[model samples]
Target: MNYEKGAKEILENIGGKENIAGMTHCATRLRFNLRDTSKADTAAIEAVDGVVNVINKAGQYQILIGTNVPKLYNQMENLVGPKEAGSKDSANNSGSSQGIIGTIFSAISSIFAPLLPALAGSGILRGLLLLFVQLGWLSETNGTYQILSAASMTVFYFLPVLLAITSARRFGADMFLSALIGAALLHPDYIALMGDIGNGATTSFLGIPAVLMNYNSTVVPIILSILIFSYLYKWLDRVIPETLKLVVLPLISIAVMVPVTIIVIGPLGVYGGEIIASAVNWLIARSSILAGIVVGGGWSVLVSLGIHWAVNPIMINNIATSGIDYIVPFTFACNFATIGTALGVFFKAQDRDIKNFSMTGIVTIALSAIIEPTVFGLLVKNKKLFLSQIIGGAVGGAYLGLTNVYTNAFVFGSVTTFPAFVGDTSANFINAMIGLLISLIVGAMIAYFVTKKEERLVKN
Candidate 1:
């Protein structure tokens, strides 16, 4: 296919990969963080034979080339080298014009992207534990079950600590100080305090009314706290003498910030999260079916533009407040459609390189649930496959809506949410399972037949 030539040409048309500072792919596009958007020849790139579409969003230039994008991505990566050519620029531009909302989303996505593999691994382990327990292979009281469940639960149960460290690093705050903040939030004392408050007891920290809220399995509070910590840490470093700064700054920051977080920041963050969560819940309750279709069909598009992070807090809040969320279940169905369609391409591809690329993309999508490789590498170019995924996602989404499935966990997509179904015995769980299975089967079947017909036509 002369992938190198194609990649080089594409890069050149977009003013060379050097003009690109950072790049990520989502279901149907190569989202490029460019040095300057004006340098990109969007029209020229779109004129390329396999290119599908072009979009500019969230300060990124996106080139859509359909499902076989991962192959081209690899070739582009090879041409451009491993590290992004312009990360410094990306970091600089990150804090500039996008506003506070943009900065927050960018920070969260960048911080979490590296840790997603571990997160998924832990989720899969948790799902397996549930499966074992459900099948009677392990009892909840058994030591083996206890150990395995701990392996999975530890990550989610102590998630604040993890986020504290990652968010600290992302915002350039003191890691230890951030960890201390998270630890305080998860402390037994704090939990007890929250319980007391819930039971109609008043609590105060140094005469200030203490607002007790559980931070476990929560997302927004920790991130927000760390962002505040970052600015505080920076200020402390500036005022304190350099030699004493290292030792004393962290100590002072922790002492001040931890109390502030507990007594003030955490409560405000939780309250804000509640408001956003309530709005989303109102929307879902009012029109779950429409929400399902819109979220399911367009989530990849949202992710492509980095707008998906806005929904993260809402999903976590739904789990925290309502015990389940419909958006996440539909998200799973959407990813399943992408993976299934990719699997079809892997099986049906005649070109050796294309076949190998599709196979690898299937594995990546399964483990990481990153759909860009599949969307750009295979489906977007293959009209039948693209239609198949859309149809499958819409069908699954409507089914989820009709059944009113709710997911307790936060991971997005089908395979990861499988365990969420185990905790529920209602028709919602069954409907979710059916939605996933139907999306996989229908998307794959349609892709197979369609791809075969297309291949035959090309040969003729």
Candidate 2:
């Protein structure tokens, strides 16, 4: 692939690897945190043969390179060294290091990435169980059904444990310790205690009463707890003697942080999460149409720069507290737009390789809910196609908002989310289907008109 030369040219065009503060790659894009956004040569980089698109958002520079992105990412990382981009940015330099909106989206992508495979596997199993029950093959109360349901439900029910482990790794903390902390939150004793307190129960440490909260399938609390643990672990390691450091530090951390987490951090995090959830719900309750438009239209932009992780917690929190979330319907629109746009590119493209890639990407994204492959492969190469998807997404989101569609489960954007609709036989399901259809139609229509055949563009 002449990746060395390509990597050098790419970094040079983007003002060199030195300009990058941190960098990471999703399935199809190289996301860079650059020190000087102005130094980025977007047009020049786009001219590179393998380059698909370049975008700047949330202080990160995103390079779309499609499914073969990992190879390019390896080259870029080799040149730059792996590190968090923009870590050196002074608070003033970045202008508020991912504002409230940025943080929300960042949280969603970060939380979901490592756990997506497990989520997909479990969701598929759940879907199969639902199918069996619907077909009279097994009763919901049957032992076989119960076992199968448990296999699928366990992932979600004990999600905090999984999040804790991944979040700890992301933040560079002790994995086992993080799981222990997550376990503490889900302890039966704690749940029993909270239940006994009912709506009025609160536990106190010293003189401060711990805010009563549950942590199952919760997001913010675990991530936040891991962040604290990361810092604490680092500090403890520095102070403790080298010979005994590993053993002593872990012991102390578990002894102190676990209690502190249970009594202080965990409760506080849960309370804060609830507040945010409440605010979002209030806004949705008041004007779902506006929320839908903003979320659906802007969701791709969020995903592109790895900011979508922040919102997953909010949606999960909504599901835990409110039994449903309208936000997920908007995400469905976003995925459909990507799929439709990719399909459009597949049909319009004259290059055999490009056409094949686009077709494969579209099918994979639609089936697996992984849009990066399509986004970077097809839409990024065709700016008009990208815009088409966004426009289509906005339209679908608006439609869904008007219908007040909601999803009760935390499934990714694909067929897996169908079960979420099954239990809720409201207009929400119909609205979701309509939203998906609208996104597909609008995106395909736009792409059909905007995309140029490879032969036509190259000839011209």
Candidate 3:
């Protein structure tokens, strides 16, 4: 693919660099906050070579370009220049019109999208380390194991720091100040206070008792704090005299926000995360098979709608709160089901373009666990293939749910990361493998037969 040429065409169709208010990219999509989305031509953009799909959703114009998105994004970024920090784009200014749900979805996607690669890598490492231990190749007490464990766990343990950096970018807060707040929440003294709380040791600020909770690996606290800090910093920037702005702004913002976070936002955010996790847990507990069937069968639909990012927090919170999560475990089935369906297309489809595209999707999905190329490029155009995906995913999901398989770490659902499915019992991992095979074999079989039947009908 001529990324540079394709990038130029994309910019031209998206109303040129001048139309862009903000620009970012995730694993497989370029997200643009356009000053006037109406000025952008979606059809023309999609017609560009290497471009798979163009979606105007969640207040951003997203271009799906598969695993090569980062390379193209670099080209586009070079052309557009660095996106202005805290640009007041329509996406930022028109939150009210987008409604609460859209606003939240956009915020979550923006804040977490960039972090997925790091999270996925660390998760894979965690799984690998566990495999080494289980196979007796690594001893838990060995210094080598300790260092490797730290490498795998560092991102998760200091998640707030990472989240603060990303959240600051999203909310237009000073990254350092936001990160300072996250660090302050995890200060060793504050963590020690968790132990002291039982000994009648309580801390207070301005006569208000501060609730000291472990903010390490928490999702919502830093986000809520940074959101409030953004508003405060903007107001401060407006009021502070131009000469004293540099040091005074950060000083005052940190001083006020950190204490406020400890006193109010931290506890509220913790409670909020708990509530969301509890709701998911309650659903899973009610009827695991039903929950699995819905999530697994409908997972691709959520991704197609671009709202699947919303589930990330719940999965993270489940691990932080319960030491394990079932969400991603079930999605494993969907991932394999997608791979199987794509393979079916490669084998059965008559069109040269569709067959080649399906082969590309299979390799991409198997390695990176990204399904956009498959879901958007193939399944959306073929009802029979999609039905195969739904039936295969549901059957696998039901089995996984019935068996209650879960994982301790958050990993991408892919062939390489299958070790991440290690659960409480040996049988748990076995059951997960069975689910993957069931989804793959069933999806391929159904797709193959259905496409053959379609061919017969065409002949008639």
Better of 1 and 3 by lDDT: 3
**Residue-wise C-alpha lDDT for candidate 3, range 136-167, written one tens digit per residue:** 89999999999989998888888898999998
* Candidate 2 Cα lDDT to native: 0.72
Please tell me which model should have the higher lDDT, number 1 or number 2: 2
lDDT agreement of model 3 with the native: 0.81
Quote each prediction's TM-score.
Answer: 0.76, 0.79, 0.94
True-structure RMSD, every candidate: 5.7, 4.5, 2.9
Question: Each prediction's Cα lDDT score?
Answer: 0.69, 0.72, 0.81
lDDT string, candidate 2, 236-344, tens digits: 8678889997689878878877677777777677778878888988888898888877888788877766567667767766765665678888898898887787777
Worst 10 residues of 1 by lDDT: 451-460
Off by over 4 Å in 2: 1-23, 34-51, 67-111, 198-200, 204-209, 304-306, 320-323, 341-361, 372-387, 415-417, 426-428, 446-460
Rank order by TM-score, top first?
3, 2, 1
Tens-place lDDT per residue, model 1, 1-460, is: 4567778878898888667666655444566767677888877887676675576766556676655666787888898764331244555665553446655655655556545555556655766676787778989899999998778667666767888887776677777888988988888877887564552344787888766677886667888898888889878888999899867997898888887887778778877877888887788789887877777667766655657866765775575456566778888878887777766766776766666766776676666566765665566666777788877776677678767887655675745447765554546567888987777777777777776622421110
